[model samples]
Target: MSSRAFTAALACALLGLIASVAAAYVHYQLAVAPGYESFCDVNATLSCTQAYQSVYGRLLGVPVSVLGTGYFAGVLGLLLLGRRLDALASYLLVVALVGLAFVIYLAWATIFVLGTLCLLCLATYAAVVGLFFIAGAAASVPMIDLPSRLSRDLRRLSGSPAALVLCVLVIGATATSAAWFPADSTAAVQTPAERASQTAAQVDAEPPLTDDQKAQIRASFDQLPRLIVPADAPGASVVVVKFNDYMCPPCRQTFDLYKPIKAKWAQQAPGKVQFLTRDFPLEGECNASTPTGSHQASCEAAAAVRMARGAGKSDALEDWLFARQTSLTASIVKEGLQEVAGLSDFDARYPQVLALVKSDAALGASLGVSSTPTFFINGARIAGGMAPRIFDYLIEYELSKTAAPVPVQ
Candidate 1:
């Protein structure tokens, strides 16, 4: 390629990098915020809020988007500055490809775990894939004389297997440290309060219930907490409070089961049932109860939920978050929430909301609720989940007690 053409190609790559990083920022903001007025909640089923709030959103302790920002910035800088900077092209190509591998992994998670698709996120994915190819093109740039350099490196590899192994290990270690060590992605770096919450949750282990016992308890409750509330109805007679993690897979399933009941009860009793959802994101970003980062983008997703809650759209946002839970990764969940819920501006006022959500998580721990989908029916606790039929049976029993009835002979 001519010098001009090469420079042009490099410019395109740099532009893509910039776009990807910006998209990553949008994704991260939506995934971490708390609310339904997010971009992902555009539709009940096609929500980014759900995907962003998932466990798959995070990698190690950092927001995946934050990592993306750094990675793309590096690539963009390399491309823009490489012609004048020594060894810039070489480093850019190698680092971009390595980063491409990680991005590919996240893309796979988006397709497989978070089932929803974000057009912007897909565009970012395309940019990464495109950059991987651009890196290949960059390798051919004249400044580095890569072919000869690689030949020598390969020759060294051919003769010294131990040296090759050591080189690979060194490269891998460097990449990992670069990704994980920056304060941005590092573990909660835990605050004292968070540390205490983590310690308390760890120490207070609740005993597991038997299957039959679990069934009996689920059967005893009339309705599970649902995210949405009925309009033009009386306040609920039985309030079921739910402490949930957006990224928690089992919680997603349990939420699905309870959703129908919420709809049914609201239709049947019209204001006799209400569901109060509190954030319990497993990511430590804003959640004091999380000991370690398990779910990737959970903190941002939780923030989105908090934001949505503030807007009086908590149920709508929570359901939307869960509905699209499969599409978002932890990185983009917060952004999805922000876009769909239209509460991007409310992010500044959410620290207290986040704290309250975290406190609710701590309360869940205090109440001896370890796993998610923990249902409290008017102060009666039902730990774990239940079968749909069992829930139906329980609801009928509760409804009968309140319903006017004829006496049996």
Candidate 2:
């Protein structure tokens, strides 16, 4: 390739590499930082946050964007070597083509399956395509000659097995290091409790809502059904409303965390705390607001829970469902309803139960709840799953409002 051509190729590769790195950084932020909105999160349909958090975001336990970052960096390094490393550049073109193929698959998934478009992801895809053309143009030599040229280069470099082995080891080590050290490592290392505490602290720092906002929130709250709290419970001055999906992993985690806390509230403050659970399934089968296939069994489970509630076994069925969240299926849900709640006639009540589930979902939508495990403590909204301590803080804050001020002597 001419010097000018090579320079242009290198420039394109460099630009593409930078974009890949940026996309990877955004993916890392979405994964580790709760409530972190990217500039690319333009709307419900064009949200980078939604696209990166989907099940397809990761491959083999590693984020795909992280892999893209390493791939682009390797391509950039090969491009910088110029025509002297033409054989390696040719090999990298094949690698870039493979990466491009994967990018195409991800693009298809983002559009048709996930029903969202992540601008950052599209930028990475554009980068991969650019790198493919740049590397292909720079390495004009035919693929059939790649092996011979590479072998000749290897022989000329250090005609020794030790040198080749060392080179291979270096490449492997570099790739492994890139895989291990993703962006924002500190965020990954923080415990869930610490992250939750930080999020709650941020929420707490916000100015108290104006009277109009509080009234609006309360009016929204009145649209939902009260959860089945203990009838004889104490002051019950604080209402804790949770918008949750039965199949959501975080919702299960939050439920388990709140178990003991709920128990403590029942023991200490009785009627003071009223915990209401509302359905917000992310499956389109029943929830029109959610994209299809987001949560496969959520709609079914929500309907089953509604039937269980009619059977006066809401808590028992919820406990069983949350415990086996990973294993939930239509059959399991039906079996649990029959066994846990002794609702052998659940099939007959399917229509009624589905209606109730849809009602709860509509209520959640009206409240602008787009995620699971969102909490409203006395009309104060807290989105996302939180640490038990944060829940305690919220409950106490609500309790304080109900406390009678001391009479001035």
Residue pairs in candidate 2 whose N, alpha carbon or C atoms collide under 3 angstroms: 233-271, 234-270, 234-271, 234-272, 235-271, 236-271, 236-272
Top of the candidates by TM-score: 2
Q: lDDT per residue, candidate 2, 1-409, as tens digits?
A: 5567567656766666676667767776655564344667544456665566666777775776666656666665555443465565577678778988998999998888876677878777876787677667766678988778878876665665655565565467546745764443222333446545654565556565555655554455456554332223355688888888876656765676677678887887766788888888877877788866455677778888877787799888887776555446777888888998887776687777788778888877777777777777766566776546556655655575575522211
Best candidate, lDDT: 2
| Per-residue lDDT of 62 in model 2 | 70
**Residue 10, candidate 2: alpha-carbon lDDT:** 66
Instruction: Tell me each candidate's TM-score.
Output: 0.42, 0.60
lDDT for each of the candidates?
A: 0.55, 0.68
Compute the lDDT for candidate 2.
0.68
**Which parts of model 1 have CA positions greater than 4 angstroms off?**
1-235, 323-331, 403-409
